[model samples]
Target: MEFEVVVEGAAGALVAERAGAARVELVAALVDGGLTPSLGTVAAVLGALSATRVFPIVRPRGGDFVYDRYEAAAMEHDVRAFAAAGVHGVVVGALTPEGAVDRPLVRRLVAAAGGLPVTFHRAFDVAADPRAALEDLAGLGVARVLTSGQEAAAIDGAPLIADLVRRSAGRVAVMAGGGVRAEDAADLVAATGVEELHFSGMAAVPGPAVHRNPRVRMGGTAVPPEDERRVNDPVRIAAIMAAGRAGAARRARP
Candidate 1:
């Protein structure tokens, strides 16, 4: 019955708050599947969105969920950093070489998080089996699990997500995320019977690079190339918020 918007920056957090989101998942390098944000970025987002809780992501690197000892150490450091900085929660997950949830590692990180909750990130999607992974995460006492239901997108995996919700049965919270758009969020919620939804309310922002660079001309060959970057846009955030609210409303209706 609630939506949590993932904010790539302070701007996105501000928009999420204005649009009445329950919480903000803060991260930097959104292009890299959301690595931990800088201290300044975290502080700015926390300060800016005083009302909305900020859950700083603790992903040390993008790409695969399997992390080496160094990366594991780095993720732990990030977890400690976020806890010290007073984040409401930390979003993180790690897998073993065999693609099973690293229970011991996750337990240590969850303890390092202090009193803040630990949300097992979408790395759960890549697990060998989502149902088994959910049981493992539940046993580890993870507060929540963010997943795409083992499908490419939440909508595609709604049936599985619904099953996950039913299987979890309050032992742990099941949050459906990944490729969740405004229009389809309600359907996802209804199909999956999940109470929490997550999405990056982003839009393409104008590039800072100029169309042409005279200093870089080579052999009288100058060709302009198009570039685009997706960043948090307040307008898009509002729209996503509207969609989530509409979904909640529909679900509440008799």
Candidate 2:
């Protein structure tokens, strides 16, 4: 049973380390649901937190889990690059046209991970059938699967998560993620018996004001070109980690 924080940058890693997290998933542009982090970012986090295992997301972009041929190629390259750079694991996933787990393609990606642990990311939630997908992922030797219990939130999906936990039966790790806050992680663990919890621990940060082109507004009104949203914040990360640790400890005690 361990807690891993998803870190978008060096600042995030620092927070995770200080909070005593077991590991950190290094990614970039969490604004887009996390893209592959730069090599320097990976290197820096690894150097700064030598003991904490770092797993970098392998997606070249953030959007849908289904990737085209070119995107798939990029994913392979990203996995190799991360492995060469000494990352502990690569987090990735892909699906087929029918919304089923793309078993063959995903297996290839897993193989490319080159002995490093591979985690099937939340793309598992989109699988047409979660039970079948879990079996498929286990067969592919995926070290873990990051899922939201195929629901909007882990708590809401706790039943399915518990079912999957029973189904998996230690064949592979089932990590409960998505919409998980420090407050709810313990409940999720208790209800589903999941040992790994994941979340961004995000907070709002100021970005550039997005404004539409006023000079070209001959037929349009003023509108912001760019809109802002909440993103991962270091301050909140520690609190989230504390909550996870406290929760896991309580569960372990009795």
Candidate 3:
């Protein structure tokens, strides 16, 4: 099984590469559930990475997957920028008010990706029908779909993920993500039969602040000041990768 680690910047990308991750999903403001990263950050990550693929998320904002004309246009511009930066792919998805894949708008974004492969992000999890959305993504020639089967965690949604894998029939890759951990990697993959897994092996690291401000907050929500800085822990990432590979090997045994 391949591991796709979610990273925020160049430092995280380097950590992922060193930790044996196969790919990195570059994003910004992960606390907001990941938004489109800046072009400079993308360029830095691309330059720092050696073999690991970079698939930057093209979301203009967090909250909902529903996008308007302006957001769609911005996403297109970002996609083009990523392609020009020599990224491996882009992670993108759009939904309608009824929670269905916005095929027409997604088609336009995919077209903007040029020849790069696209991975429909977890927006599929909120769709009205998983099977229907899988079909639509396949029809769009998406290389993969990152989902947790509409649940808070992939293990909790393993049954639906398994069904999605069976229904996909190799037409599109079903990547199980959301709260993936080293301990549960085997069970999730064994149950879902997924070839890829996505996770953010992140942990809270202390920031370099001599004096702390108790009344200031950079985020919209209230979070502990010390918990604001999260970084990719290579040890955690390596453990997850090792556990996932071991599980895959175990399943392959006769």
Best-fitting candidate, scored by lDDT:
3
Q: How would you encode candidate 3's per-residue C-alpha lDDT over 123-146 as one tens digit per residue? A: 999999989999999999899999
Full candidate order by TM-score, most accurate first = 3, 1, 2
Model 2, clash count? Answer: 4
**What lDDT score is found at residue 114 in candidate 3?**
94
Model 1 lDDT per residue over 1-254, tens place: 66788887887888888877888888876766788888788888888877889999888877898888898898888889878987899999998877899988898899899868899999998898788899999998899999888888889988888899999999999998999887788778777778888888787766677775546643233222234456666666677667666776777788
State TM-scores per candidate: 0.89, 0.86, 0.96
Per-residue accuracy of model 2 over 1-254 as CA lDDT, tens digit each: 57778887777787777766777888886656678899899988888885778999988776688888899888888898889988889899899978888887787788889889999888888889999999988899999998898888988999999999999999999998888887787778877888888887777655566654435533234322234335556556666666666666776886
| Model 2 residue 43 lDDT score | 88
lDDT of 2 at 56: 94
lDDT of 3: 0.90
lDDT scores in order: 0.83, 0.81, 0.90
lDDT of 2: 0.81
Clashing pairs in 1: none
TM-score of 1: 0.89
Query: Mind sharing the TM-score for model 2?
Result: 0.86
Q: State the weakest 10-residue window (summed lDDT) of model 1.
A: 217-226
**Angstrom error at residue 252, model 3:** 1.0
